[model samples]
Target: MIYILYAVLYGLHIAIPFSIRTEWTVLIVIALLRAVLKLGEQRTNHYIAFTLLAIIRDRVFQALRRLCPTKLEGRDKGDLISLITSDVELLEVFYVHTISPICIAFLVELIMVIFIGSYYWSLGLLALAAFVCVGVILPVIISKRSGNLGDELRADNGELATYMLESIRGLDETIQYGGGEKRLQNLTKKTIELSEKQSRLNKLTGVNLALANTFILFFDIAMLALSSVLYSRGDIGFDGLLIPLVALMSSFGPVTALANLGTTLQATVASGARVLAVIDEEPEIEDITGKKEIDFSGASLENVTFSYGGDTVLNNLSLTFPENKIIGIVGRSGCGKSILLKLLMRFWRANTGKVSVSDVSVEEINTANLCDMESYMTQETQLFKDTIAGNIRIGRLDASQEEIEDACKKASIHDFIMTLPKGYETKVGELGETLSGGERQRIGLARAFLHDAPFMLLDEPTSNLDSLNEAVILRSLKEEAQDKTVILVSHRISTVRIADEVIGMDEGRVS
Candidate 1:
């Protein structure tokens, strides 16, 4: 409008030969004001986008926390990574650029129509049709043609990520088995499939852009031709003919933005669906909260029936462990030794039976209290890429350096750590891959030891250790047995030799 005014005022000066200094001053002021408002609009839009992204990310992480260990089993790590990172990021475009752009396009065209109508009503209707075609009708058609492509694209991307992650994690195995070529071929196949899906979506984007520009060009020519005819007819003044034509030409900016949104929002639509799925999902087992804290005593399970969907893993299982005792549970592979420990931890609810802790049902205990009372160690200890001290501190976040060293000494890892150049300050690998299996296992034991809970669940704690280190760790367990009740689970006879009473199992029952 300011440019239109400038054109009008300059035209008047050319015709009337009068000083138009005041009109020029007013136009300059309005132009500067519009620039300031535009800058503010950009900042505000992005501020809203980033703020919303943060809230969404927080909700996604909370949802994952509620679904973890149990519900997350067998889920591809790559899919979760893609959903949390790229998927969440793509939504920024929708918030910052999509919603308001559609509204602005509509309003800008509407106002342009009105301004053109003041010149002639027919010209106003023509402008409306042109705007609708390029902004609304064309984009809607393109989106319909690209129906569900967004979902497929996101899903395929996740699959490729999962495959790549698997390949990388199992690279050692692949090389050992000479399966590297096979894995590479599979990787290539997945990459090609993902690329094909992306290519199809890109083709649609190209078509939409090309057609949008063509429609815009055609509209400009149509408006110019019609206005010239009207000028010859003298139904509208020279100002109406020229000014309305310029307005129509320049006003496609907002509509063009709408046209681009249809193409860019493809990934965002799929991303939004994936993100919302996590947030909206109900956890299989909700965390127990707001209960009175319970002191650790003895723990047991009776008549428990559980399955991993199809076949029963633990059926009609029963066991008991007394306080201040090192009780051993032994079973062959495919038996329920690990699952039994997990149930006691309340990672999974038994289909039909009571898993009790401190003579109270675990389901009735406060999660925080249970965590405080029990230090559960899994077979493979997960460590983040951090200093060795940092990893060990995870067992007790507030544990002191002295406590950490003491715990590591108990696990027979302190001597090895001291031999390192940085000692406890040395950084480990992502997933602790930089360390030997024995080192990682000992670190996990150090964590459990540092926790110093009354009830300890150690699964294959010394599986990676030599006889000397194993004896040292077992002796440490015996020393702690005076203050802690330990469930020492392993198939190794040496591991169970330290137990006060060893329980033997054939299936899920005490045999």
Candidate 2:
């Protein structure tokens, strides 16, 4: 449709030699229609592209969520955040701008070749040969020369994004550790390197454009020479010669548009490859296909063994937890205490042995069903920048207002909240920075209390609190564990004493 309209429009433009012979009204109408068509094409293209981009973004986020779940121990939050937002958004160039136009341009070029052939076979052959030389061959050679650089630029951009996020998040730590100067110097070098890569990309694009422009100019001159020879031969009339030559000249706009595609699509294709890399990544563990739900009142791990890379984290570990009991896992730092909790959560599958909840192997329990029965709170509590009530609702979204308040009170945080002017409705700034360490820990405990799951795992829940706060939190846990299984991890022997049973670990093994 774009071709038919364009060809007729170009033919009419050439037919009216006198400026006044072209009816002003008809030209205006054509201009308006053309504008409308272009607008519709762009709008429709963007609408479909953006919609698909939204799906891609969702899938990228889903992959990240699966890769770094709530129980992820050491991954950087800010780095993951950068990947989801900026890195994913950069990919819109590929879907929206590049693919549609590239397809449209090729279709238009094919139509032009057919139109030329209908006029004169020799002329048609010349145009076809020129199109293949400039459009096909030149682009392939240029892209081959520059494609690796484009890929390198994109990889550098991803790394730059990661670095920026890391620097921002660790600004305070950097300053405290007296490493701010060194880190900033490193970032400055990275920024300069990124700029250099960008400069190289720009130079490549310039070279491609310059080459395409030069080829187009040469093709037009050659076509003009051929047209003049045909006119002199008397085989082609002057009017016929004039019309197609003018049309060809006008048609160069579309050809140039097509040639420019190599420059336009480079960034988008590079970004697309980056996105595909993440989507194609296989997870460390495959989900069970037809796992059954199990009643997990009690659980145990028998000779469980696991490793990350060549270093074993848990070697022949064995433990059993009875129903309605609170177990404390205590050990020196870097022991497999946290690794055990991760295995129980199935965040990492054990290489050998079995983990079961009430004699039903955890691997055979549906993931969603297992999530419904267990709640694990890591050492670092991540609170969104939302109202206090909103953060607590993450534990059990449907909990009534009264239930929330009761949980808060049990966690010994209700009084602190009441002290604030807005109380439960008060906003906790990013990561709950507005509140103290004690407050964040209490909020975490409140979440566990509100969730009221059959199994609860708390890693260093009271590590950030004072004696008074810790005692109050321990008392709250005692009350909440009445009919539930609780696993507590801490270095404080005093904190460990509160559990119904204590398990000590050393060097990735039970001691």
User: Where does model 2 exceed 4 Å of error?
Assistant: 1-30, 68-91, 264-266, 286-293, 430-432
Best by lDDT: 1
* Location of the lowest summed lDDT over 10 successive residues in candidate 2: 14-23
lDDT, candidate 2, 148-240, per-residue tens: 676667567767777877888898899899998898898899999989988987888788888987887787787778877887887665554
Model 1: per-residue lDDT, tens digit, 73-157?
A: 8887878888899889889889889987887788878999998888899999999999999888887787778887877877787
TM-score per candidate, chains pooled: 0.94, 0.87
For candidate 1, the TM-score is 0.94
Q: How many clashes in candidate 2?
A: 0
Instruction: Write down the lDDT of every candidate, Cα atoms only.
Output: 0.87, 0.76
Error of 2 at 276 (Å): 2.5
Model 2, TM vs. native:
0.87
